[model samples]
Target: MSVLSDLLDADWARLCLLSGGGLRPRLWRHVLSPRFAPVLLIRTAQCLHAANWPRLAKLPALVNFVLFGIEVPPRMHIGPGLVLMHTQGTVLGAATIGANVTLYHQVTLGAKDIDFTYTMSMRPIVEDGVVIGSGAKVLGGVTLGQGCVVGANSVVLNDVPVNYVAVGIPAKNLPPEAERSHEPTIDQSITM
Candidate 1:
């Protein structure tokens, strides 16, 4: 799909996410909201960058960084339905972020080391349906599995399995919900 279509899809997805919380969201209102400005600018920057206009792309990117405190590299590949819950201090240096990913404030996804050279192998690859909590740092070349949740203030170094929850300082995966079944209750009574 074209960049405009992707942007529209992302806006709609964000609207749905907001409406899920019981607040009716109007498309026009959402489009004009300051909260959505970063997404718009970032998408615009991406569009410009994809068109081989790096110099022009930097304009929107610079605005986003200055105003929202969100640093998104123009070269970063973000799929549709991307939602930045709160953009303050959020830096995205991922190789590729899949569709329907939500990232909260103060989240950082980048290289583990101080490599100024933006190499794909040095960044994280976030899959679809992932929700990274606020203050989370996912560094290095690890892949965050689809449908996984990374807890707030956690640092993920290793790969998290699909549909698993990763929490704590050095994040560790919790067993998948399917494997966490409750034991059956047994009735031990003598019937007459």
Candidate 2:
């Protein structure tokens, strides 16, 4: 799908999420909210980039970076249903992110090296339905599995399995039983 279409779909998904999946709100409601400014701006940047207008894309991108303090490169691949909850200090630095990914405040998808000489595999890959908690840092070439959850203030330097939760300073994955019983610290709707 086109970037604009993806953005619209994502916006609708978010609206559904916000409405508790009861009623799908009108498009105007999604477009006019100040809370969705960061998302709209980011989606616009992605659209501009995909249209081969990197020079033009940087304009809105810079605006988003400044206004929301979030930096998501237009080149990065993000599927639809992307939700950035509490946009403050959120940085989508990953090489690839799948659909329905929810990110909270102060989340950093960062590189472990200072330069690109380390190879293209140095970037993070976040799969579908992943929820990265606030103040979490996912560094290096780790692949976070689908439905994985990173706890707040955790630092993930390695891969995490599907449907699991990683927590603590260095970030250790919890057992399957533990994950089933534990509820993440964010809205449950985005887990779709």
Question: Can you write out model 2's per-residue Cα lDDT over 1-192, one digit (the tens) per residue?
Answer: 465865667666665686486546446566655557777887888888888998898988899888889988877878887777777888888889998888889999979876444344888999999999999999999999999999999999989999889999899998567546665656775774
Report the Cα lDDT for candidate 1. Answer: 0.87
Clashing pairs in 1: none
lDDT of 1 at 12: 61
TM-score of 1: 0.87
Candidate 1 structure quality by residue, lDDT tens digits, 11-110: 6666567548643534656666666778888888888999999999999999999999999998888888788888999999999999888889999999
Q: How many backbone clashes does candidate 2 have?
A: 0
Give the poorly placed runs of model 1, Cα more than 4 Å off: 21-29, 181-192
- Provide the RMSD of all predictions against the true structure, rounded to 1 decimal: 4.5, 7.3
Give Cα-based local distance difference scores for all models: 0.87, 0.82
